[model samples]
Target: MVDMDLLLALASHARYRPDQLAVAFEDERLTYRQLERRVSQIVAAFRRLDLAPGDRIGIATYRGVDPVALYLGSQAAGLQPVMLSWTLGPALPEMAEALGVEHLFVGAEAAGLHNLATSGAQVWDVGGHTADIGGFLAQSEAEDERWIVRRDPDQVSSVEFSAGSTGRPKAILRTVRSDVWNAWQRILAYRACEGDRWLCITPMNLSVLSGMVRAVLVLGGSLVLLERFDAARTVAAIRDGVTILPLQTPHWSQILEQPDLGDIAEPRLRTAVAIGQRIPVGLARRITAAFPRADFVVSYGTSESGMITALSATDPAFGTPSCVGRPLPTLEVEVVDEGGRPVPPGVRGDICVRGPSVVAGYDPAVGPIVSSMYDDWFNTGDVGQWDQRGYLYVIDRRSDVFESEGQLVFPGEIQEEVSRLPNVREVAVAGVQLEEECQATVFVVSDRDNPDIASIASIEAAVARVSQVSFRIRSVDRLPRTLGGKLDRVALKRGQW
Candidate 1:
């Protein structure tokens, strides 16, 4: 079993398609050849730190092309790069210590902006000036690939944070084999090809950005990065030319709300993938009408696994609520009981998966990496079921479902029903502890200035149609979103919204 070397693959791109566009950020653009050279320079720069192969380096940067190059540079240098965001202020030190990071490359957005106590790890401000990353690139004038470290295929490739909604993020450690397999799978799963331009708004700290970067690089495609997401800017980028557009459902909602969205259509836009959460039928229809040529897919995946299931409009259960389509090729997905036995179709149970891309464990905060797998299978902690026709339906997170009034209340069910209500922009249902008691509450963001009494009644009726439990409805100005632009459900549960 031979593992593919991502560095070698990237170098091949530079050799074959040197002039093709690789990355675009603001006014700066780099061809494949230039990007490869930059990676070599970063590798040369990394050497000045007296760092050895297998040492951990933290990348805390803003949305830009440098993070992409730094990531590849880390791979070429045999350093395990742990991604961090500037938004993580006080918690940065704790995470760096836990991951055993030896050095941190801080981005310009983080320089002097936030105090990131990095748990005794040496920090380098690589955000500004020519050869600013600790003056490592300037210290050495080497442009050769001889500095590239030959690493073991089984060695940890990179560490990424888990995208769970209601828990402290985990540092998922993916091996070289897993990452290589994931990149290849994404190229196949997304049907990516040469010259395709990927619109990347998600920061490098998220797995989606890195995965897209690898696939795009492998296919000789381009990455068009946006420093910040604006509805008009996104639409303009699409009009110019964009083939792959991946974002959370909330982002799509904001785009759909664009006043001039319906006035123009982009023919070059081919794919619009919905991430983070399931795309509701209403939003799905709107996206189809907006970008009729594009294939709006509802993708369901986790940090441990690259991609599991995705919902496409062509599937029979495309519009069915919670139906996330079938698993992609080469991956094994199963719905199992508490005993780890496979459950029958139509029976809800824990979702588990086993495949080459499934990460074996997470980076522990203190000791060594701890395995999260059980008997070669990884439990997704999501409860779902399969229909008779082989379509998978995700119900909700295990912890998000609770008992109330002698009935199990799935927050997704309540939120899904209420999301259909008129004038309700967004909705989140949670059974959170308040003061001394736990109560079921429906949080909403509406267009009206005040919470309409009639709307509240409609929300209760909507939940009543789904379950017997009662819930209190409160409409707020806006729902909270994470740094990765995902709905912060845990923050909502904590009354931080």
Candidate 2:
């Protein structure tokens, strides 16, 4: 049986390895013992506030130690922690009200935002010389006591909002059991060890970030936290013995553009896990060349499901185009047609997953929005296919695919193919609706500031090889991406290009 109390496990590590580093930010480092003490104080503070079981606590803080401590501490005190992204800005107040948040912790930088006052909850500022609430908490009397709240396994522990790339982001629920299982799955997939040093560059609001942090802590590993992603700084950290790097696809792209990347020799870097979206083969190859010593992994998952599939460096599908690897050992994955029947290998279908890692359902206020999809199996709303060897290749989101001349065309596939062009720097492909049909349009970011006609012709030729439908090619300075670093296809289709 899995231990549902993650804080208790963290406390055990603190007792055994008091001096070991638990988390590091810039020049400041906190040992396991220190981290445990801080968490205990936070838990006591929550009790002092009279927060009860299931009371929602929202955290909208910059990437730092206090946010991590508050997240784990909230759950330990029997409150459901909600990770609210600072990017939500004006929309945050409504989201918090909908989630029934009673208390909110905002980073010092974001504390002065006007919408925060309208959240209808008591707010505390954390970090950066600000008179933060965390600093006011008195240390608990018994630091070694097991202060973890005991609750039913299926009770919600954390609430995360979906990436609002398509529309309004929905609140997804995660139980203690699912959270624990997700951590274990990540640990197994990454082969994380007690001695590993995890570099956390993504925002804490992301589900992947929480899972990565939990996996490292559960395995007695240390986390190196960065307030924000800086390519040059990240490269330097890698050279300084950071072993595991978990980042989004856009982060990899930005890191590749850094001129100082080749100057760093990172022998300690073992794994670089790519989350958020599918990565093109050309870009993946560049990442592998840059970090020759590190394993480049592509992970597929969502807010509702922890990690459904992962492409490991050692796996045969690592270099395969669009392959997200096989289903995780903890889950069952399937690709089915519109009728919900399983599709044969090599045929595209909606990807669905069901297992311990999948959450029970959304909160009642979300009102069955995702329950139908989450019934017996959760339809990911993504199109994918499995090879004969069981390797899964995610084509694109189901809605992102459009029929062109009676042939279903995936913009992701076209984008991937166009990205292989030697002169193309970045690319985004979207289908534009025409009379009675949709046509593919390719937007290219050329290596040269002004791509000549010849360069455009070369990209068109590359895209033509995999696609038979007619396509329009345009050169743009750069492609627009959502806050989470995913291509904003909805914006593209709306002619925001």
lDDT string for model 2 (151-175, tens) is 7778888898664677656677888
Please list the residue runs of candidate 1 whose C-alpha ends up more than 4 Å from where it truly belongs after superposition. 1-5, 113-118, 128-134, 162-164, 366-372, 447-454
Error of 2 at 437 (Å): 8.5
For candidate 1, what is the lDDT?
0.77
The digit string of per-residue lDDT tens for model 1 on 1-497 reads 33335666678888998898888887778888888888888888778878788899888775567778888888888888888766666677667777788887777766664556647787777774323456546656545767677766678888985534554667888888778778877766566777899998865365777787778876778999887677788988888798988877888888888777776654588788887687778788879878988887888887788878877777677789888888888689999998989999989999998988887587667345345589878888899999998888889988688776677888887778887877777888877778866678888887443355336678888989988877878868788877677777788778665
- Those runs of model 2 whose alpha carbons end farther than 4 Å from true positions after fitting are 1-5, 127-131, 134-146, 364-374, 404-407, 432-439, 448-454
lDDT minimum window of 10 residues, candidate 2: 127-136
Clashing residue pairs in candidate 2, if any?
none
What CA root-mean-square deviation does each model show from the true structure? 2.5, 2.6
Shift in Å, residue 62, candidate 1: 2.7
Whole-model Cα lDDT of every candidate shown, in order: 0.77, 0.78
Model 2 deviation from native, Cα RMSD in Å = 2.6
The candidate that achieves the highest TM-score relative to the unseen native structure: 1
How many steric clashes between backbone atoms does each model show?
0, 0
